[model samples]
Target: MLIHGLLAGSLALSGTPATTAQAKIDCAEVKCLALTFDDGPGKSTAKLLRILKKERAKATFFLTGKYVDQRPALAKRTLAEGHAIGNHTYSHFSLTPRLDDEIFDDIKAGQQAIKKATGLTATMFRPPFGHTDERVLRIADELDLAEVKWTGTTHDWALKDKKKIKAKVLSLAKRDGIILMHDTVPQTVQAMPEVIRELKKRGYHLVTVPQLYSGKLRSGVSYP
Candidate 1:
């Protein structure tokens, strides 16, 4: 009876959610790099997932609620294939200029959408265009989400050149660096294969955002 009680207590302490028990990569033993994509589950995302699978790489997808509603299967697939899903807002609007209530609603809606589709609530969020302030942070805290930012980016949204995108990511790759890209961009999809290859050649481990910063995620704090 005492052994059973101890086992049940351990389970209770660990939380009853599968999301909480997901395995994480040891970033300390590996040259970890988090490849995070925002504004997606879009047209190019399926192909992006294929590339990631082919490379045996993992990533985090920060999905807009509108798109999650439109492409639920893709969002679900991201979770199915062991990638982390994060909230990128419902409308993908700039949170910096919005009212606190509006920001809170959009963020909450995004979380609800992901939960509805994937059966998992996102513990991470990245504000649209990396914009956020105190109000945004407070609302995120209420939602139990950690605000994530990027350590580097390919600037692929503005640039259509695939080679430049690949080169930029390679140049900026570092230990435990978070590389921001958009899965909605076709050029980004095109650039991802080579970038994955080159990053592997340079001895970097591709991991999700949570895996890259395991045990360090704090609500309301922005991780760069």
Candidate 2:
């Protein structure tokens, strides 16, 4: 909760444009990890927020348009808590096998939905189902959003056991790694504390997606 305390002691930020509201993360010389949750702003998201706060960790949420529409306040809170937001498309549709124009529209819709819900723009995009090709990269490049991929996945969406989720994530935790997870899963939410504590014990400075990239993310680059 150190970052949360730091956030309170620092300047007050409101739900404003991203340029004015984004927090500057300082993680120089630290082993940074980017915890990214996809298909979220869901029923279990608030609990995830509490866990992140308890861990004093910053994470990134790749939200779908409809989920943001369902829980706008959660989306806003995610940004307000000094976390980053990214587009996961409007319908969580797989993009690689889809039409290029359709993929573009979905990404745009998700971006607009995020801005509407959080008063911040998504500077990153995670392809739904982690399916991407040259066309997906092109669309992301055109939108000026960095394409973020993960180095490890907890498989929390398919796995129902919290212990397994914790084990998978902890086993794969590494420096400068982006972890793919989901906020919609309750077990994953439950597994967070242990995973965070162990990672912290090992000296990882959990950070947001942009913080992991130090704001120098290359366009169309798939960060791990």
Q: Each candidate: what lDDT?
A: 0.80, 0.78
Listed per model in order, the count of residue pairs whose N, CA or C atoms clash below 3 Å is 0, 0
lDDT tens per residue, model 2, 19-61: 1222454546556777889898889999999987765676788
Q: How well does candidate 2 match the true structure in TM-score terms?
A: 0.87
- Which residue pairs in candidate 2 collide? none
Off by over 4 Å in 1: 1-24
lDDT of 1 at 151: 93
Deviation in angstroms for 154 in model 1?
1.4
